[model samples]
Target: MRLLITNDDGVHAKGIHALCKELEKYHDIIIVAPDDQRSATSHSITIAKPLIVKEVELPDIKSKAYSVSGTPADCVRVATDQIIKDKVDMVVSGINIGYNLGTDILYSGTVSAAVEATLCSVPAIAVSTESSAEDYVYENAAKYIKKVIEVAVSNKLHEDIVLNVNVPPIKDEDIKGIKVCKIGKLQFHHYYKETGKEQENLVYKLEGERVVNHVEETDSYYVDNGYVTVTPLHYDLTNFNILKDVGKWF
Candidate 1:
């Protein structure tokens, strides 16, 4: 299969390269990623200005790669609509530095890239790792995705659905296998800090405290318990169940 690989952590990140190396061994790889980190960028696309894209080289990457001076979603948008010189079977995002799990994925550029692909009528997979540890275990994530792609491609995934995968950073032997689960409501504790520099006027930084999620049948819980979680996500935001009741109010 011909695959379009992209990520939010820029084209130079080790995670994307590791994924490309493993995937290129079996499928034709085409990488188009952000020029720099664009995490939590959501699904925003560049407009009213020219989107600058350039062909670049990644160390040990045999596939054709490009860097886009835009968000992760922009990379997918441009790649499918223009940058791609040929046909692509699927869009595979991430092997991201940190996981896009539960409610956190709503603000994740990594998942949004895959969401963009789905909007373009292409099947996509967004893979991420749970830990941002110094020893980032990416090879296992890549290899795991290989199997998923094989199954997904053979079965022909629905264009509206994206497979959101989150893997624990532990060794393969320690992994508790895969779990298909729901998206957990993982709420985070964060606050904006006021910088005390007289030279600068009101500079603040967002600092996070704790992320809480304990739902057993959800993505966060399964991943936290040593399992690789797979959640099938759709781009539709409509609350169909409430639509009928809302119409009655009129």
Candidate 2:
């Protein structure tokens, strides 16, 4: 299979490299990633200015890799539209350093890249880790990602769905296995702090409280309990169920 691999963690991140190493074994891989970390960038694309992309080499990567001066979604957009010659069988984003569970998906560049692929009518998967602990387990995540990709490709995933996977950062033996789950409505306690002043502009930094409550059968709950959670996502934003109720106001 031919796969386009990308991530928000930049071209040199260990996570992306780990992903390239693993997937390259059975698939022809093409990696197009940001020149620097673009975490929490969502589905943003570069438009105002010309995007700068350059081919680069990695220590142990066997795939063709490129570094782009743009967001994660930009990588996929450019790769699919211009870079690669043949039709890419699938798109895989991440092996992200931290979890993209629940509402985190709304702000995740990793997941957004995969979403961009799905929007382009390609099967995609976004993989993430639940912990930022010293023991960042890429091997374990890679194993599960391989299985997930195989299943997704075999079924030829529908255009409406993109798989969002979050793996617990535990030793392989300790993992509780995989769980097909729902996106939880988890909110982070965060605030914006003014860090600097530049002329008439104010520089603020958004910080999280690093705490959350879990709900059963949701992405957070499954990942918190050591299971790899897979949640199918789509681009539709309309709340169709409430259309009739809200229509009464008109």
**C-alpha positional error of residue 176 in candidate 1 after TM-score superposition, expressed in Å:** 1.0
lDDT of 1 by residue, 157-239 (tens): 98878999998898889999999898998556678998676675777889985476678799888888999988999999999
For model 1, where is the 10-residue window of minimal lDDT? 130-139
In every candidate, how many clashes are there? 0, 0
Tens digit per residue, CA lDDT, model 2, 1-250:
8999999989998888878888899889999999999998999999998899999999988788999999999999999989998998889998899888888689999999999998888879999985454434987788889999888878878866799999888888888888998998754768899999999999999988656677889998888898989999988889999999999989
Q: Tell how far residue 57 is off in model 1, in angstroms.
A: 1.2
- Quantify all predictions' global Cα lDDT against the true fold: 0.89, 0.88
* RMSD score of candidate 1 (Å): 1.8
